[model samples]
Target: MPASTPVAHSKTAALARVLDAIPKGYCRYTQGNVSASKAESLARKFHLRYGIGCTPAQRVTRRKRGMANALLVMYWPEGCQQVEWLMLATDGQGMDGEKLLDIADKPGMAWLGYELVRRPDRGRTAWTWRRPASEMAEHYALIAEFGNKHHTNSLGSLLQRLANQPGFHGVREQSKRLFEEARRRGHAGDLPHLFYVQKVSHGEWLRLG
Candidate 1:
């Protein structure tokens, strides 16, 4: 479909429609070529509506990992040609916590994972980070604040903000580590604006450079 085409419903509705259209047991992979083909089709539909690319090359199922479930690999494109993976549940339901952790623990791909569930009744989608909420309360707050201000909740945006806050030396360091890891994983993005710590009589603050 043309990217400019007006979707009949919101993006979330489109996602729900795509997922709901999948045949029962299609996620099992045991359904054979029919299932695989349907998955690819649905993935493409999702990509068109959401601007997140999903192709046959990026598809991975539980069978591939020796697990007894299904997974959807969705990629979010970044400004600097970087793409991050989000392993979503194939059944339209939220993913299991243990299952998500198991996938994260594996040595292959590093993903910024989340459980996205389509709420047909609510006419939207709900998102929950795979990590524990308590462990990331502060980061979540920061992300929410940034999203509220800039209308985006992308990790890159949060990292950019952190990189500009000199008072957050630890966060800045963590951002560097994430950037390096992203680069190592072939997910390099445009460099965020640089900032420096400036000293004053009252206290220290961030000074954009």
Candidate 2:
């Protein structure tokens, strides 16, 4: 049969067979030629869609220190340069001692760029991850007022306790003081946003919101 045969086997069936042959627990198993081929195909697809370049190198190096090189295809607007997009994609550990941000600020590149950020590391603590400490304080006050007024409980006390989790003990911590302030000046409405900005877990705050 010719390589382009459409008689006995359909393209969908052939693709399904390939997928089915992929062993269970792939993460534990080492990636083989199958993975590299797939990576190259993805690279080509990304090139076509995003007007970026793809390397035919077919050398998808796997897991350098438990983190693999992810092949990402990005589609930016018209006039976006391919090299600029590549630089943005290859950031941090993939960085090759070059100044990425400075390169991005150059004339042709800056026009084609926007900020890129990774998802917040889930392992970080609330206090550590909270943006703008003052905003967090305001949110603390809001949650506290809501709990005291409607729920007849002050989340401020709970959050205050969390802030002093390792250092302070008992209700004598700063959480108690925060609650006192929230109770003294009352607040309410839109509990989720308050929780999003502070010590409360998104899951719990989302339910209450």
Return the top candidate by TM-score.
1
Q: Clash pairs of candidate 2? A: 160-175
> What's the alpha carbon RMSD for model 2?
17.7
lDDT per residue (tens digit) for residues 30-86 in model 1:
111123324335445434433223223333443354332333332322222322223
- TM-scores for candidates 1 onward, in order: 0.22, 0.21
Q: List the global CA lDDT of all models.
A: 0.34, 0.29
Residue-wise C-alpha lDDT for candidate 2, range 1-209, written one tens digit per residue: 11111110222222222222222111111111123324334345443432123222321232233322222212222332221112122222433332333322322121111211112237641111112345446756576566666653455444543454322122123344554555555533222111212222111000100
Model 2 alpha-carbon miss at residue 187, Å:
15
**Number of the top-ranking candidate, with lDDT as the measure:** 1
> What's the TM for model 1?
0.22
Q: After aligning candidate 1 to the native by TM-score, how far in Å is the CA of 196 from where it should be?
A: 2.5
Q: Model 1: how far is 184 from its true place, Å?
A: 3.7
